[model samples]
Target: MKRIYNTLFIVGFISLFMSSCNDWLDVRPSDEIKEEYLFETGNGYRTALNGIYRKLATFDLYGSNLSWGLIDGWGLVYNLDKAPDDGGGRAMKKIATFSFKHSELTPTTDAMWDAAWNIIANCNNLAQQVENEDTLLFYDRTHERDMIFAEAIALRAYMHFDLLRIYAPSLLMNPGERTFIPYVDKYPSYLSDRQTVSYCLQHIIDDLKKAQSILLSVDKSASFSMESRFIQSYNGESRFLGYRGYRMNYYAVTAELARVYLYAQKADEAYAEAKKVIDVVESKKWFAASTSSSGFNKGNMKMMEDIIFSLYSTDLTDWDQKINHLSDNPADEYNEHYLCLGDELVNEFFGSEKSSDWRLIYQLEGKYYDYYYRTLKYNKQKEGTTYSKVNDEMIPMIRMSEVYYIAAEAIYKTDPALAQKYLSSVKKGRGIKNVDYSQVTSEEEFINMIVSDARREFVGEGQTFFMYKRLKKNLLGMEGYSWKEVEAKEENMVLPLPDSESNI
Candidate 1:
């Protein structure tokens, strides 16, 4: 089932708390905090930041829609072209036909698109306020302003990069020829058709570069010290409100930059950026996933070691009540939607030992069909309290592990040998003991292999469709039997601007 956009009211309520007293829904920040003020100080800035994080966790955006619902549920169920017309089902169904109009998608999908830009709007608003900051609360406005500005730019860059991936063509195939959805840098002014895929890619790169510049300006000591002082001084409730999770931290911003560069095919540059985090990225403890939750709870966003960028919430139990019921059974709490891999692709990957592969094994009775093995990485728990839920499971927008894969693939186009080194790093970690070094004979083969691994590893995590689009691979049957015949078109490359935004 597709996730509905019914919870937009909650988002609006959150927005109300984040806004200035003069204008609750408005994007602009004000100088003073009134009942309506959204950005009067560092705390208000934090609230605005929390607002963006909230959007990331919302049902319409990453929380359910972009993550499990759209990517896993819709894509998988529609593998044979069987898309439900439920509240969130349209995009997945329409994608295969290359027939989704701007008007056809659910408000949920529309809100995700809008929410990303809305984040950009917030970042812009904050960036302007921080640049001209005059709030009496800060002892040193310049230093604080610089850090906040960097985070804002990084957040904007992150949001824009995400928008481009879903709404643009592959960067490798005539990137200069394809159009992307509207690239809103300043506040969105008018609805525009797609730009050349290259244009969109370039736009992302430029924004990221700006983010890197602003982010680089921040003093590392100051990063930890500012929040530390706030925590030390404030009481519990005050501290909780003060530390509301928002704003791109240093690692999150850098991790996303590595990913953007990798997609742009700047392998060496991507590696250089990723290398900066090698220590942080490679630490086994950091990358180790938490396993405390059950069923759908398993996929809940918890603070894992390697989560460079993710959304968070203190209300997971409530979230569980709302989205958890959709899971078929207690132990079978994985994504209902997925890219139904055609028999051929599954056969190719599984070989004769298909049943031995963990991903191909069916654990639950009802989850599998004759040809399919439902993914278990996101399994929900079988038992829990009425309000039982998991934390540390947020929508993973970026992660350090992605840096490994992106670095591997990006380098394939440049240094094939070096690319293999990076590929082995991940493959070895996944327990694929001693992969044949000779298997990656050429760039194409290497890319194909790595991407295939990516699909399997990141299954139900919302990375596949963008990847297929980025590689310009034939949509049909790229991975499996039923999908072997799909071909995405120009219109398919970039979804039309949503009518809601266009009409506005």
Candidate 2:
């Protein structure tokens, strides 16, 4: 909590706000802020918002933990026993087993909550300030002002939805009244618990919708431009107009709304919104170059061409190879750097079409790593190599393919044919010749297909846990717990609120 205040007062917050527009989104300042004049100019507001995005990309936030570290480990994407002794190793194993109360897991979980809430508090501060800002102070005379405000709102909802997904129970599992976490709306919000699952979810959806409405006119990223990946002078519009893929623009907001509706079990609305994204993206012919593992081995490993929203960092190349993908397997299994699957899990994961899956062909071959079989999803462009500037150092938060999956999942029960078409399209994109849908006669089988595809499609992306949690399904256990049945605890989807929040 004190961290949040320290941020608002200064401690790099003010420095980031005062940074030149050219480097606003690039470098985070070491020194802090001058709170009194933080919002005096339009650049101040822009820098303030950029500061929040930078925070979101920190190692404690999406840069590692929430993206592919803690959440993915919990999703059982990696073999729990293979968890390394350092770099969140014990915490990863405990979280995988739902040992939320264990001392090993406390620091990680508490940091997750604190880091997320700190970003949310900063969002609240920006929202509070921007509402009263003079539109004329902005470069585009309300366009930039409105864009920042809308982005702030959408980002707030995005983080809130994530917090709700992590900390609270879903309506599907618990229909009865139950307490939920606080919906901190304003700056310096007194975190309290008076909300319900229904109340918090509705507010999140409402906030997204409000953001979408405002961004409708301000945003031009219906089909995102590749140039949006970089910050350049578009007649002094680079700060706001550029970087749509990283920031929360109109389509990202719409995509997020579809995700929320699906979570709330409103399949029809979810399908409608998802279809909107799919149609626009396809019509625009965006990501047409995305084929054969969607830019694997070509430096677009993160699938940037089709990514709807992502987070960027300059530090990705430093720790990615050594930490996630080690050159050789450790002598002690428990001493491994990160979790990875063995031949057995790999065979089961790929099933009969092992040769067809491009992920196996490109991402996991021994050529990439001399000994260990690891997914090279996060490796970025470095000192050499002729990959495009947009190829590396990006982590996808959501992408067009997932939107297709959402559409397929949402409408499967009512319209299986359309659903299969949607699902098959994605499979086809992954280089599969033909998908046999005859065996998926039942809705359960369809969902199983979805789960299998998601597990395969998002190997190191950390989406598997949320998919499991949303559907209230069991997590696939590893090592001591067999895939079939080693124990009888239902899926540990609910990450308990930290003592700091709970005890308060």
Top-TM-score structure, candidate number: 2
- 10 residues in a row with least lDDT, candidate 2: 13-22
TM-score list, all predictions: 0.73, 0.88
The pairs that clash in candidate 2 are 10-33, 11-32, 12-31, 12-32, 14-33
Q: Write the per-residue lDDT of candidate 1 for residues 384-407, one digit (tens) a residue.
A: 432123323444566555777777
Model 1 TM-score is 0.73
| Candidate 2 off by > 4 Å | 1-31, 221-223, 227-237, 287-289, 292-294, 325-336, 365-372, 381-383, 386-389, 480-491
Give the distance in Å from residue 177's predicted Cα in candidate 2 to where it truly belongs.
Answer: 1.4
Candidate 1 Cα misplacement greater than 4 A, ranges: 1-36, 71-87, 102-108, 139-144, 175-182, 187-200, 214-247, 282-303, 313-366, 376-392, 413-415, 476-483, 499-504
Worst 10-residue lDDT window, candidate 1: 1-10
lDDT of 2: 0.70
lDDT of 1: 0.53
